[model samples]
Target chain A: MNYVLENIPERALKPREKGLTMVMDKGLSLREVEDVLETSGDYIDIVKLGWATSYVYPKLEEKIKIYKDAGISVYFGGTLFEAFVVRNQFDDYRRVLDKFGLELAEVSDGSLEMPHDIKCQYIRQLSEQVTVLSEVGSKDAEKIIPPYKWIQLMTDELSAGAWKVIGEARESGNVGLFRSSGEVRTGLVDEILTQIPYEKIIWEAPQKAQQVWFIKLMGSNVNLGNIAPNEVIPLETIRLGLRGDTFDHFLNNEWK
Target chain B: MNYVLENIPERALKPREKGLTMVMDKGLSLREVEDVLETSGDYIDIVKLGWATSYVYPKLEEKIKIYKDAGISVYFGGTLFEAFVVRNQFDDYRRVLDKFGLELAEVSDGSLEMPHDIKCQYIRQLSEQVTVLSEVGSKDAEKIIPPYKWIQLMTDELSAGAWKVIGEARESGNVGLFRSSGEVRTGLVDEILTQIPYEKIIWEAPQKAQQVWFIKLMGSNVNLGNIAPNEVIPLETIRLGLRGDTFDHFLNNEWK
Candidate 1:
């Protein structure tokens, strides 16, 4: 924001309860994390070590420290949670979170099947230890969960003590909230909005088009997740109506 | 690369003539450039400051110096050349190259309509100042060039003084050498290869599938361009058959 632009959207500041942007860290080296924090840390609220990548990323503890030191909450992707639960090592998963000094955890069953009650129980259990972000939706592109089920799952998870329910789109933005072609399931989102408050859900939208769709539908303060590190600045521009896609979105009627 | 693996493709070292990996730097900060170099510099041979981004980027010279110090060649994207030529700033463009102490330059008409003779003359002019890499193909997805035309342009450009001719696919890998859907024009590529030397062409393959296609087609030593900074290590794995996509491509017949 070098030049002050008229009709820019009002954006929430740091420690934001809303308009949170969660970035996905697949396998960034230590220096890459430092660079991301230095460049786009202000726009990011959370960093998700995507899926089981944290399990194999060599500098996992150091990476978490970098994010935490920057006052950004770091969490493991839900698939990592599923990885632990399916291996019957939920206790170990908790220990791993403690070992990494992570204050946030994501409980998701996208890769595996878990009974809803049991899922709620895991959310409840994880919430007791850390702020839980329970994800709802199957990673399987073929398995399209109905909007009603999405609302139900989100509500139950929130009731089960989760801080926010994450709508799964993976890192590709090609499942869950989006169709295989990366198109948003408008009807599903509309139906879910009837039950789940937009502020209470962080939609995983990795693609630029999906981000634009969310920003337009939910306004500038929408919570978004699974953002690539390189896209934080671009996403912020879109949110502030600085970029071409949203340039007219926040303009005054008189200007139009 | 930390552990030795049997049947891994022997990748050419830096200052390589072929098997070059030309990364696309789309407005990376100085720190980001350092991070990329520290993490994946060994796998990269050149870095292209993606399309006219060099003009808008704040720390262009510092970023280039970092890449140069890391023993990797750096050049402006071909679009920048067109930007200069279209604005009749060809002389200024050459001065900018000298101002930045750039040893490499790209001559391309991807976004503009330039006569073949005029394009070659620009290539010849730039070649005297720096090692020139002339790109062949249109940025428009609707504009499809036949194989013979591609072959003719590449041959003429090489004769004019291009060190290598680059096949355009843009950063999205959805134009020029590839279809709108990001699928490679296999027939066109095969026909072009029949007349053009494979070693003298750098295919702009920003997608994993396209990289895999080239690596499989040309063994492990094919030159590739427009690779994202993060994809360097992943591309190296693909080249070495360490990744699942090409795991069998380089393995011993007995092992298979």
Candidate 2:
């Protein structure tokens, strides 16, 4: 791809392990998906059908096919999984994934409290058939999980056949690794990084400042998720220091 | 439109004087435009080509025609107007607007200073042939305008033939009517409302929380602008008290 500025920062190409961007599509039309992929598909790695929205979204199969055709993995939000699991439809959930030809599944109990062992078992079981992305941390801002507990759950989930353990910040960026005000829990994130490999964790950063923070903290290759559709291009600009927030981040050689 | 819940507050239909939703388009493809109109066109009154994006945007005339055909008014952002005015190209700007068959215009001095009288003169002249949206308050967060002055400018602009004076919270919601933290300046907003008619002003509420504040304070009919393309449906829900934030706002007998 021709860039206006040369060598801003090289992002790992498609099928990349790091610098991954996962967009949260609440409900986009077939035309909308086509529009995004046609312009910014190279930057997007996956599209998460946000929070049980797929159950009601029109043309679900066609949308998934489009994303897959564009080489972007597509998965339902973990809330759908929880909804199914809560109703004892584990087999039905698998059937749903199979029906859609999905190979990536998100295992999250953010809204509901499931036993950690049971959560890991689901992770272990699902990872056998599809890539498992187990999410850690509660969805509620009031239900605080200690930093060490966050580390423990993440480590356990990763060990339990998960491909990548996502740190839950929700789509709103309130709760989990972030404060209700959308401020990053820097100390908590810093502590988690000490125990987990950065590439193995996809930070759910839906806000621009959060994206800027993650990019600045972990460089251009930080994996970010829950991004809005229109923001994919803007986020790429931030990742490569094409935006003002990261303009001097790569330019200064003091740390480089 | 079939809503999930019946009897939600009815928003004014198209050609609405209030409850106006203005989306900001920062260059979207044709397919994306179709997606927006198909899903939430009824909620959108105008689409602003953000900043100077229209200056370099592809198929600019085509995009405007599509939006117009969807019953949505289209206008260039105030930044573009300022850009042309700074270069003494007001006549050229008018020629461009006429060439595009745009019936709406935004007159703003947010990025740079222009004498209020001169600004009003421009508004008076532009309002003769087309609808004018004059923006009040500076774009710079540090350049704070006092509550009384904000009231004064808005009042004068409306009198000078602006159809609606926009409170410049910006697309980021971090300036003009708000603090850098995206918190509304309550005293300022309250002071402005004391003099200016609420329906005569379109509050630039790009954030959900900001939209909620406006909806609760001014009811569902409050004119809101700078909404992202995907947010039109979400914003409409908030207006109709479908969302949690304003769920009880319209239900209360005292509020009704």
Candidate 3:
């Protein structure tokens, strides 16, 4: 693509396996979806319906179609899955995904204390027909799991037929991999990266500063998730070093 | 209007003088405007085309028309006013507003150091034609003005016939009325409220915490500005104490 400026950091094209941008759709109208797609559709990879919000949003099928037709993968938020599993209605939940003709799904136990093996069983079961993105880590900021435990769970989830394992930061970016104040836990992140492939874990970075930190550490191709809808273009700019925050780092790179 | 739940802490009906919500629009297309108005039009009082972004935004007139049709007033951001003033194109700026059929305009010296008398003169001049919302305080957070100076400028600007004097926090909630970290300058805000009516000043509160602080301190009817477009519904929830942040504070008030 011929952009106005030259020497911009390269961005991964659609159908990309890396530099993924997963936006959390709390709830948006069909027209809103069209507008977003018209503007920044190319930059988006997956659009996850946030939490159990999909259950309350109107016109779920039409909205899902709007996203899928744009080549963006659509999935129910893991909270919605947990909500179903807690009620012992996993079959009913599968039927709902079928009703929407969804090809992607998320399996998570962020809101529940399900056994690790049981969670992996669900991931393995769903992987037969859909692309499963299983999330590791608790949603509660106080529920700090050891870094080794996070690595172990993620490794098992990936081996259990999961397409990618998501690091749970919640939509606020203030839990799991981050502190209650939304600051990323440096040692925990560093430890996880040592054992896991960076390309396989999508970091939930819902804030600008958090996005900057990840991009600076892993460059433009790092997979990031839990992005708010309106921030897509801004995040893409940050990725390409168009914004002032990351301008000097890329422009002054000694080895271009 | 009919709502899912009644007894929402009474929101001041629009065309209202207080409890005003001014959202910052940083170049959204017309369809996006329609979707937002369809979902949360009643919650918005005014839409400020953010910074000088309008200069580059396509279909500005159509977007402005959409906003006005929704009964939400439209004004070029104060940065645009400063842009025109710096280039000595205030007449051209007036012409642009007239051509757009705008009834509201912003007068600000946040970017340039125009004499206070001259800034007030623009307010006085524009007030004869359009309702002026003059902004006080510099956009640079480090250029701190003493509390007494903040009070004097706000009071003088209001007397000069500004419909409302905007406390200049910019859209980031990191300058003017706030510290670099988005913390409110408590003494300055308190002193300003002492001299100027809370209803006559719109505090630029772009962050959720800032919105909470204003609502909890000034009560629900405090006018707020520089709110993000997507945040309109959330802000209304905050205003009505529907959200957890301020639920107990207003719900348990004796008035309810």
Estimate the TM-score of every prediction.
0.61, 0.63, 0.63
Q: Would you give me the overall lDDT of model 2?
A: 0.86
lDDT string, candidate 1, B79-193, tens digits: 8888989999999999999999999999999899999999999988888899999999999988988888999999999999999999999989999999999999999999998
Candidate 3 residues lying further than 4 Å off, grouped into runs, are A1-3, A242-249, A252-256, B1-23, B34-170, B180-256
User: B1-30, model 2: which lDDT tens digit per residue?
Assistant: 311333457778889999899999999988
Sort by TM-score, best first. 2, 3, 1
Mark the 10 consecutive residues where model 3 chain A has the least summed lDDT. A247-256
The residue-by-residue lDDT of candidate 3 on B1-256, one tens digit each, is 4557756777778789999999988657678788889888988999987765555454677788898888889997776676556556678788888888989999987766678899899999999889999998886656999999988888899899998989988768898889999998888888888888899989999999999999999988899998988998999889988899998887655674
Q: How good is model 3 by TM-score?
A: 0.63
TM-score of chain A of 2: 0.96
- 1 versus 3: better TM-score goes to: 3
